[model samples]
Target: MTRQILLLSVMSLWALCGATHVKADHYRLEFPGMDNVLPIASRPANASRIFYAVMFDAGSTGTRIHVYTFIQKQQGELPILDNEMFQSVKPGLSAFADTPEMGGDTVRQLLKVAKRTVPRLEWKRTPVVLRATAGLRLLPEQKAQALLEQVREVFDESPFFVPNNSVSIMDGTNEGILAWVTVNFLTGHLYSDSKNTVGILDLGGGSTQITFLPRSKKTIEAAPADHVAKFDMFNTTYELYTHSYLGNGLKAARLAALGALGAEGLEWQVFSSSCLPRKFREDWSFGGVTYKISGVVDGYTGFKPCYEEMLKVVQGIVHQPQELKGSSVFYAFSYYFDRAVDAGLIDGTQGGMVEVRDFRKRAKEVCNKMSKLRTVSPFLCMDMTYITCLLKEGFGFKESTVLQLTKKVNNVETSWALGATFDHLRNLNIH
Candidate 1:
């Protein structure tokens, strides 16, 4: 019952949000007169009523569209999440940094998916928003804004409702918070006073996030001020420990590990690492830039050197939360799950649990046998080692700490998009 009321409240808040453009930089929901909000029972129940929301996840590596359909079975109750239509395209919007219109074209192509998923009659009423993640955040300010302006023009041209500030770069903190909301909400752990909520580790291409409801007050007090956030929902205030580490994402880490992050001379420079197969060399493109990467043919190639190189990227860079070493359930997703799958550490379809040491174990095996594993990605060794180092050293998780690797929950993509959608609706659209 509490969860239901919360969901209804979420719907109310979403409605209020539609009235204006929603900035994704900070999530501070302040609902005035929330105490006197009408009960769901007071409103007319429309069992056949349905609504849809369209969210665009502009990430470092790809751009995705999520179309959510909700059914209001009765008043004063949470609407049923009927289904989601999702699609994605590679080389994310950031790839078009030099060509803003081309980036908008990608969004235009994805909007076709939304057009087909949503009913024609509901087109004008449906809210469409695009939120860029670390990908855009990593770009130059002018370039990022240019890309956003292009997307804004596209949104305005579309039949959907284009709210103000609909296209913008999301704040790293809010990214973590929304993703936490997504996982907890899907797991049925969003109830008031619920202590069973799980923490989330999201490893995107250009950034990463760690968010959880701290069980100890010391966790909050010890954390950096920006690491903690408080928001009101369901008439309850939640203070969560969350932070997004920009430039620490999988792809970005690879660049940093190769010593090619922000360096020039990409055309003549060769970024080499001991993590790759001894003979491996390739031109990799990430976030609209290309880098020449290779393994040191004359140097040693194995886990030790690779782990050492990765250490420079993780050690002392990531914060160590005091409570993380204690008993806490965590869900690791995005690149954490992807790299685990690539390394054959877990089943791709059915995600499973593994300890922090499991990643280390796999990193060793993959790094030691790079020559024999021709079918695997050349960066597999580095990626695995990075995950291992990031977990054990970056965040200071115990080797035995168990992490649930999941790609989806209840058939919906486990990301901040849904949570952002819910937030978008709560603001109430006045049309």
Candidate 2:
């Protein structure tokens, strides 16, 4: 039996730099740290070869580090992955886009966590890498490149093995693909047939991704050329329906819904919407820009109009795959999980299954009772409504569609970072 170990109560996301020497049954993993937390088991023949890897996820909203430890029981066999040590810092690297050096400083600070976790002797052999997501993608090319260059300089100065192209912006397609891989791997579904794999829905701050293996040929034929992606992992070829919509993430959608996405003259403009509390007013910041936002003070507020407002962001904009209307397994994470927890729709610690209509029902309740629910986020009404519209209108899922909201599987976070690490290891041929 294959024992898959996933760490819970740790950090979330990717690593920084190079490759490793271990290969698992279907994938390769090399992350270092958290070994001390788990008792070291003595081994015979191979002496239990251990390897380490550090991955940094430079997301639009925050920067996070994941240090993973893998133990190889025998040569050429799958390494037993242990727990991961995760850490994070907020306001994301994009916030420091104009000040590239400051952005680099954040990475430097995160390296401290890696340094303290991985043993000193293993530093030189451990690979470190950083992959920026939608946040950096939205920045001007010059600014984004500048920030990436600064991070490269930081990686060079560190003690770990930094590979070529160690710090760069990750394309949206790969983001979705990797996330799908992470979830399926954690669920022990990687070695099974494609139909057994679960789809993934990732709502980041700057983008949202939807990826799944389509069982119907119509889905592949009807989708846009770019929406279909094919990659090789674990010696198997996977052709998946995947796409990451930039500017469709939770925070990005909030701006788009307010008609403030690219509007200028933020100093005087107060973008208002019926989705917020009637008296709510504040400044919101995203991707290095800030905007003044408020609720319609004397105007109408509630689910009816809010759903219509959010529908504009989804309807006609998000492509509805033909097969999604049928029964399919999907795991939603990131902001999708966060908002559901905030609305009492699901437990934060223990995720649960919910129907597509559940979001709609909750949106109606939350939007209609915003005043009494003042303790929750003022934007709850808007978010819940938007999610409802995105699913039923944008994605074309049936109201009865079941969605599994989760952050972790077993003990490990279901994130793209793990899959990306496996991809990195395969590229290096570290063995």
Candidate 3:
């Protein structure tokens, strides 16, 4: 409580006095309320309380952009998140590996959203950046660089301010950390009376990331190399446990569970697995590659066999964090929220909290139904089971562990994009 009051006091001093140098990279876009006020950057700077930043999130499954407007509250105080204009496009940039132009075009289309959201007068001032995640990270080295180069071309063509380091692929460690920052910042945990922070479980299509500040030195010592990160924020130094598994994401794990990984003959023969329905067959596409898949018509099926299969996709591969088993709050986003909504465990409009056993229960229900319900996705059984294993046996979370599943907090999309924008703002000296 003292820390929170002191921090707010510092912010108040900055706001009321004058000159709060916000590092360009760490600036938080905020709007307290600016109906008739001008942005602090405007010529008539009294009303100049708001500034903008445009961020592009090029992920494994989709490309999204967030246009954030921040309010200065006063001349020099740290800004707060007033509002965010967000948009997304499907088939991620990696889908156009063979055609870089089309990949860049997707980015170009997203820019139209930014153009509309950010005022024309502010175009040259708002910094625009694109950061690709696991999807592009998995592409061939040359191919990934080619795709990035094409996207850079699109950024260059935009009217928005382009920072030198604006277009690049974010490392997986930073990905988890940025996401952690975004969630904490949104929850007001970072700037409040409570210093307690929540853990983040982000399951993307091609990768999954878990990040949180550890409570014990044992956790830091037991963690794998590059899994623990140390950084400074708000005059506090923090050591966070974070890691991203590249191929353990929901969609990729489905392919791995099906025994279809690296099977070249998609057109000649179908990959079969017990996780699917006994007679189900279809063409599955991921990361721009198509594979024909089917269930084992002559073999066993149902929850047990399916669970065992999906377990192999995560078990022994994911390292269990010791702190995760103890009492702590976790916020699961991306595919975690999507699957829960699909299973009717929660409403999509308002994501709900659920115990880890909830996933286990739904996995059994869905996989058991697959034998007779050939109408549904054969992979649904595997996907749900994989999610169950990921939280339980994979990460060592207990059955009673509670997870808050959400896509948005206060209307801003819960993602690393906002964190990325804040990180960029931090780079600037805004005193």
Candidate 4:
């Protein structure tokens, strides 16, 4: 009887070991410092293999968290999974100045959900890379350092317990490259072998980045020994040419419209006399320098003329040769002016009013001009309409594959986090 009991115990122990190994084969992980924590359903006990990746795009207006997973294929091709997005509270100027602890709190909350949902999740072995884009990069050095340190501190604790080797804050240029990779991946432009250089233009709420990837011949190149190194997309080795133009989408539209009158543009008195009251004009100034103008309330009644002038300026900037006319522009106008139109905050026909259609037309015209002038067509165009269509139909897998392969040919990395992580995994010989 004693011998029989021992055999039964040994058999039970063997089963437990096999189950642990199986669970480890399908792991869960989160990336960056989170604002929205993502939770996965129970892990599939029979899954062949699984990997997770996360991206945090901290912008001036808000924070976006994207969570994705790669499940090993059983037979045919694996489907590209849909990403889950979590948006943080809309940030104000005060939020930007807040201590990193404030941001850390947000990350902690997000991780709590991840811990509860992902089955047999292992924090130590999983890699989590955190990146802050134009918003934090433009903050004062002292504030930015404090924020980064705070984020690091939060990850050190908790169910996340991210390993020391797993977390990092990418610089602006690298962040821009990642953004490029994500966008291209979604649009289906990533390629494995091509010499096509890509220019990525990202316009966000608080800042804009213009990135240029020069041609190269390698699929992936390591960062240089120097503090700063070049990154290659696919077959193309590329250098980063980026400008963090402060005051992105909203500010850009406002400034462009207001600056139209040139030096002679309306003075405060004229501004007050037009549709806007004195208090409204003053508030619009925010902290920026105000332009002086004549014409009191009486001088500016029936100000339709002023509104028209504003529209003209906005149109000209959008179509300007020196601006985005010839570049492969990827303008994100969704966040901007959403409330304005919805709330009837401004009359679209007013002189200062700018509509989405206006920008779309300008983009179309620029593409047409580039096709004629340079004989090099604008490689890609992303707007609300395109995004909507892609989302509705579920971007066809073939198109996605073609795009990724094309990006590889151009030597540029597709802007997908999974693709980037896959490249990282290959480097580590994990696959």
Provide the TM-score for each candidate, comma-separated: 0.89, 0.88, 0.89, 0.51
> For every candidate structure, what is the RMSD over all alpha carbons to the true structure, in angstroms?
6.6, 5.9, 5.9, 15.2
Q: Per-residue lDDT for 206 in model 1?
A: 97
Error of 1 at 82 (Å): 1.0
TM-score of 3: 0.89
* Candidate lDDT values, in order: 0.83, 0.82, 0.79, 0.38
What ordering of candidates by lDDT runs from best to worst? 1, 2, 3, 4
Angstrom error of the Cα, residue 259, model 4: value is 11
Q: Candidate 1 lDDT, tens digit per residue, 95-205? A: 999999999999999999999999997787778999999999999999999999999999999999776678889889888988887887777777654557799999999
After superposition, the stretches of candidate 2 with alpha carbons farther than 4 Å from their true spots are 1-45, 192-195, 373-376, 428-431
TM-score for candidate 2: 0.88
lDDT (10s digit) by residue, model 2, range 235-301: 4467789989999888888999999998989999999998988778888888889899988988789
Candidate 4 backbone clash number? 40
Question: What digit string (tens of lDDT, one per residue) describes model 4 on residues 1-431?
Answer: 23332232222212211212224344222222321222343555655545455544455555544454444433222323323333344452225455567776766666654554344455433444455554565566677767667667766775443534343344544545555554444434444343243445444554544444433222114222221235543324444444334444443334443452223434433332232222232323321224542222454422243344334433322211122222232412233223222223334333123333443343334323332322222111112222222211221112111111122111222233433443343321110
Error of 2 at 228 (Å): 0.4
Model with the higher lDDT, candidate 2 or 3: 2
After TM-score superposition, the amount by which residue 65's alpha carbon in candidate 1 deviates from its true location, in angstroms, is 0.4
What local lDDT does model 3 show for residue 364?
89
